[model samples]
Target chain A: MRILVLGAAGMVGRRLIDRLLAEGTIAGQAIDVIDAVDVIAAEIPATGRITIDVKASDVSDPDEITALIDKRPDIIFHLAAIVSGEAEADFEKGYRINQAGMSHLLEAIRAKGGNYRPRLVFTSSIAVFGAPFEEPIGDTFLMAPLTSYGTQKAICELLLNDYSRKGFVDGVGIRLPTIVVRPGKPNKAASSFFSGIIREPLAGQEAILPVADDVRHWVASPSAAIGFLMHAATMDTERLGARRCLTMPGLSVTIAEMIEALRMVAGDEVAGRIRREPDAVIEKIVAGWPRDFAADRALQAGFTADPDFASIIKAHIADEKQRVAQAGA
Target chain B: MRILVLGAAGMVGRRLIDRLLAEGTIAGQAIDVIDAVDVIAAEIPATGRITIDVKASDVSDPDEITALIDKRPDIIFHLAAIVSGEAEADFEKGYRINQAGMSHLLEAIRAKGGNYRPRLVFTSSIAVFGAPFEEPIGDTFLMAPLTSYGTQKAICELLLNDYSRKGFVDGVGIRLPTIVVRPGKPNKAASSFFSGIIREPLAGQEAILPVADDVRHWVASPSAAIGFLMHAATMDTERLGARRCLTMPGLSVTIAEMIEALRMVAGDEVAGRIRREPDAVIEKIVAGWPRDFAADRALQAGFTADPDFASIIKAHIADEKQRVAQAGA
Candidate 1:
């Protein structure tokens, strides 16, 4: 088996690549790391083919992806996307890169006809749903996205299901919760604070809480996100069939619980670095998002995540400790 | 009120234009018409400017729509789309026109971010929902589209809702049921037979029945579809708020009932013109579509349709009879 990781330079993309490389094989084959495509240059933990290009650079330029498919990667992880904040702010750039770029990749595979059926694992987000909450949203939720980014993701999910049913590819779209305890410099996603409240405090830096303590959200750690992708790639195809999209399992908690978890993991001194400053824009956008989701189907499919908020904090701490040890800092 | 009709050459589009012209006003204004864009060259029924362009043109080109919107029509009736059969046959064209074309319109509205909130009436379809019947599909049913056409429409619906809520455009997406007794040449839509069986028989011609008599479907008359577009344009924005997409009311009946209605209207001789031809492809596709839907929300919002299937047939016959008399054929 061989694998191709699109957007291999991004945070989740980088971690997913690490997981795949560390595993070394898929479906019993001695897997080869065929390619990694991204705008930013990615460091490979192991020797692998790489093609770094902006997703806009004529992805269908047959030369870009055809050679890799000629080698026929058994699995393709599509993790590329503009974050919600950027997409909502820059409309043209958002649709061009996120929507049109994905279409370009799908069209490339479709051009191959019956020659291949690679497991195409696409990382979608909960942002695909918006505003009115049905309370603990079920597996079967209509994608009424409020943001451009969510709309783009929902569009891609629809395309993935149709192409999969048409036998063009074996596709799976996993709608991940906002990955909490995200180990990185703070980013622009409004939900970034879901991770930052914990991550920054743990790293001995001050972090601002934009919403009220009562504000709730669904979350999964980075490890859980990687696990969801792996499960999506290898799951029983018959169960998914044409409707290839599923919301991944996650723990729902209030911001207060997140802070409590931070205090437990890194002590109150570390938690003291967090500050509260409410902004209406953030509150309004966050209000439209789903606070909790009942991912019963994913759980039934044997996909698991951190069962509680504390576990998520513990996972983040362990991950940060490992990074620190590697850096010798 | 000024109005712009995007697909003014279509059967429904032409009828809508006629209705609006006959009424002489919409929402209390003198009903000034602006332009009509369509694939074929045609005369506009309304005393407005006319613009004809292929539905398959590069609609993303700002120049294509800028001139039309220069007048800033108060209402935009976006009825343009490659029908189900054509879209399924030509996948790339479907995405380009149905998906990209819609984006162009939305982007245009977003670019002009002042008090220019035109009421955008987008024609959606029940095709957005596929199999596993829930009897009457609610407003919150998941968009698990079976075909590429349905997928395109669903994507557009999401974009319309998002853009509208963001105050870019005051949008309303109306999910039209298959129009029965379509008064025109036999089109290639899989569902065309729903109209063809009735219309062709009334015209004293043989009509092929691809599926069995027991095959059930949701349908609306051409007039009802027009009513839906008008109602969507003029409805209370506060009640609709962010959720601007709706499933319009339609009559659900099996092929046998349709034939019965035909027999009542034009006698057994005309009904007997319907030929039985079992087609598995049609059967397979139809199987995944909802046979019945209770659009209670639409009805509650004061939008209505023919109470019975017989009434639907009578309306079609009455309208076509006038058309035939006017033509003096």
Candidate 2:
């Protein structure tokens, strides 16, 4: 199997590459070649049995997209996108990279013509849903995104379904929840605090809590998100029928609950590192986001989420410990 | 107000043009100019007070679209599209014309810049919603189109909302139901039979009924469709907020109910001209169509529909009589 990962420099992309290297196969087929692409040069990890190529490429460029499509990788993992706050602030850049970039890639694949149907696993986000929900939104709710970033994702989802329906590509879009304890520095996304409050404290650093403790949101672990993408790439798409997109299963938790989980996992000292310095801008942005989802379709299709916030914290700690061990070695 | 109608040669477009001419105004403003465009040469009706320019142009061409945008018409009525059967048979042409064409027009409007936000009234269809509906599909149901035509319209709807939200264009999309008692001859559309059975019989000719009498579908008259377009063009869009597209109000009835209504309108002699010749292909296509819609949003926005199928039959008969009277005069 030949695999290609777009946005291979991002946290999820890098982790996914590591997982792929460790397994040495996807869907029981040995991966002989791997092409990892991003706007910034991606790191090429040493795999004894597999050929790896890491390159810097802009997905919005026609030539770049065409070159990648010409390689005709068996499975394409598209996980590249601008975060919410950045996309909202820079509208043209967001639309160009997120919307036009995805369209260009799809058009390139379609232009390849004769029976070149690749399994495309696209990572969408729960931001596609807005405020004023009926407790927990069902899998079949309307996509009336309140932000430009969400709009772009929703538009890409429509394109994925259309391209898949026409048989140009075998595509599956997984709408991921806010990834909890993202193993990275803080970014521009309003929901970045969802990860920061947990990640920073775990590393013995102070983190800011932007919103109220009672404000709830849907989330999944980084491992679970990676699992969703892997499953989507190999699952029986025939069961998806016309709806090619599915909202992945996630844990719903409030800020207070997350703090409680943090205290349980890392003791009082780590949990005390969180400062309640409220940010009105972040609060207003997060207010429009969906709090919970049913995700029954994804659950029925064999996708799973973290059992609880405590486990999520433990998983992050374990991942950090592994990174430290590798560095020491 | 300068009004532009893209598919000005079609049945509804021509009727809309006629309504516009007779009323001599839109949104209570006196119309100064009308640019009616289509692939074929559009006829320019003599409106003593208004200047009319009818042109032959394909909306899919970027140059042609740019030229239309350069004119900067205040209200743009974009109703151009290939029918469902044609789109299904010719996939490439469907995407090129229906999907890319709409995108080109939107891009052109955006390129005009300088705060040039035209009121773009787009004609969507009920085909955006597929089968296994909840008897009456709600206003916020997910769009899962079964046909390429439906997919194209659904994609356009997403684009419309995005563009409108971005302030590039003031747009409103109305998903018209199957037009019943059509004045013209039968076309290749799967739902053509819905109008054929009623139209041909009213003209004292035999028409085939391809499916079972119990099969229900949503419908509206040509005049009602025109009214929906006019209302959409002038309605205060602030009420729409983020979701710009709406399912227009229409009468939902089974074939048996439709025939009964026809019999009451034009006597049993006209109704008896129907022949039951089951067509498997059309039956399959029609089976996946939405049966009914809960268009409460459109109704609340002051969009009206024909009270019953009998009223729809009467409206068609009245329109035909007016056409004949104009010709005689």
Candidate 3:
């Protein structure tokens, strides 16, 4: 079946495109082709008969979004959003891209009516859950977002449910945890340090730890995130019903455990590259995030993840090695 | 303190306007005129230096919302929303007025920036909480809105919390229970029957009960809804912090209790006007709404309601008598 991936240039987006184009099947139907979009022109994965358009376009632009939808892809993976830091720092840009962009896309889909009811898989974030959280946050936790980015995501989730209920489209919003070992250069998100501490050190570079070791966070590897998205795109709607958003399963661990995992994967030498420089601002912000989460509903939905922290580290190491070898010679 | 009341032409809105102007004090605040708006010209509470503006303008228009904000009133009671049934019947109209209208007002407030950060009191609804709910839905219950109107309210609540957290504005969302003993002709709302059977019979008219007697619902009086708005406008936000939206204290009872209260207030002769006409469609929809709710947080914050169902019926009878006398004279 035809598939479209928005935010194709981003780390998770890139990985998802790779996975979908490489013999990915949903509900036993083979994915024939993939069309992807990014802010900058990039290469999209395409096989012999598959059509892949890797175009540069802003999702908030009505014409751009409409043009992408005109292809009438069977599934749309909406991964476009301003990172958390940029959203918090730039209010207008945050609302425009995050809220308006999603609104325009959903409206466009609804406008297509009868013949088109694409399965929409939107990548939301754990930021939807804010401070004073109950321990072991369930899939049904109330969204009391503390940031503009989170607020935008939460609002989109509501819209997805309403649209899905109206039979305008089949939608699923997957609230992913911080993707650890992101395997790339650091971005503008406050939580970028989450991946940086692992990724930078693995690449034989020093990375700063901005918060205390006791700071806990929920996280999943890139592979797991892609799996969550794929499962969401093909899952039985009868199980999800009108509540279309699901918090994907994640491992909740302290920063110290992350360092321990790093040591195991890349030896103590790589782990030694992490430098701690505490900042109360970052610490306070991190404190507001949930340390533990209960994703029982998502887990039961036939989506799986790395069983433990060690497996996540091993997967990252293996993936990074492949990237390293590809770059060499 | 200057107070602005959006949707002032609505039945509950007008009642609140009259009460605020007549009392000259709410939670110890002094006299103020009410700002009103609707399709038709509204008779606001007073006219003086308070500068009451009663205009016919669509609230969703950015320009109109901006003009309303120009006054920079100290307290803004935002009650303008398309009623549930109409909202459900017309999808685009629901999103335009309820969702987009709210966004326009909020964006206007945000645009004011440092110049104006008025206390915004938003009236939400019990529709935000849908079925399979815990017996007593607590403050932390997830928002599983079953209708378009409820989805809009839930979306607005997220924005309210984010804006408040960012210090852009002071905002509070109060999820009000269904207002009982309404003084009006029966409308199309599925929940209209909840009040109709009691309200019509008291007014010496026949009313149809479309659902089973066991169908439970959370309820508050018109006076309590007004109280919630006023309390929300004046309460200290430090306690609420990031969690700004609250489910206001309400009485949870079944239809049987509601009819009994009507019987006790106006005698069985008036109650005899009630007729049962069970509708499976309405019964199924009503079943998805939360029967009982726990508002411990709001109650602890000092917002209250009628102590029992008897008080609610008494208040309705008192209000209905005044209406009949005024119409006769």
Recovered fraction of real interface contacts per model: 0.82, 0.66, 0.89
lDDT of 3 at B146: 90
TM for candidate 1 is 0.88
> For model 2 chain A, where is the 10-residue window of minimal lDDT?
A126-135
- Ranked by lDDT from best down, the candidates are 2, 3, 1
- What value does the lDDT take at residue B40 in candidate 3? 65
| Model with the higher TM-score, candidate 1 or 2 | 2
Indicate the worst ten consecutive residues by lDDT in candidate 2 chain B: B127-136
Taking the tens digit of each residue's C-alpha lDDT, what string does model 3 give over B181-218? Answer: 77778777778887888878877799999888877889
User: In lDDT terms, how accurate is model 2?
Assistant: 0.89
Candidate 3, B268: how far from true, in Å? 3.9
- Name the top DockQ candidate: 3
Question: What DockQ does every candidate get?
Answer: 0.68, 0.69, 0.85
Q: lDDT for model 1, please.
A: 0.81
Candidate 3 Cα deviation (angstroms), residue A139: 1.8
Q: Estimate each model's TM-score.
A: 0.88, 0.98, 0.95
TM-score of chain B of each: 0.93, 0.97, 0.93
Find the candidate with the highest lDDT and give its number. 2
Residue B175 in model 3: lDDT: 91
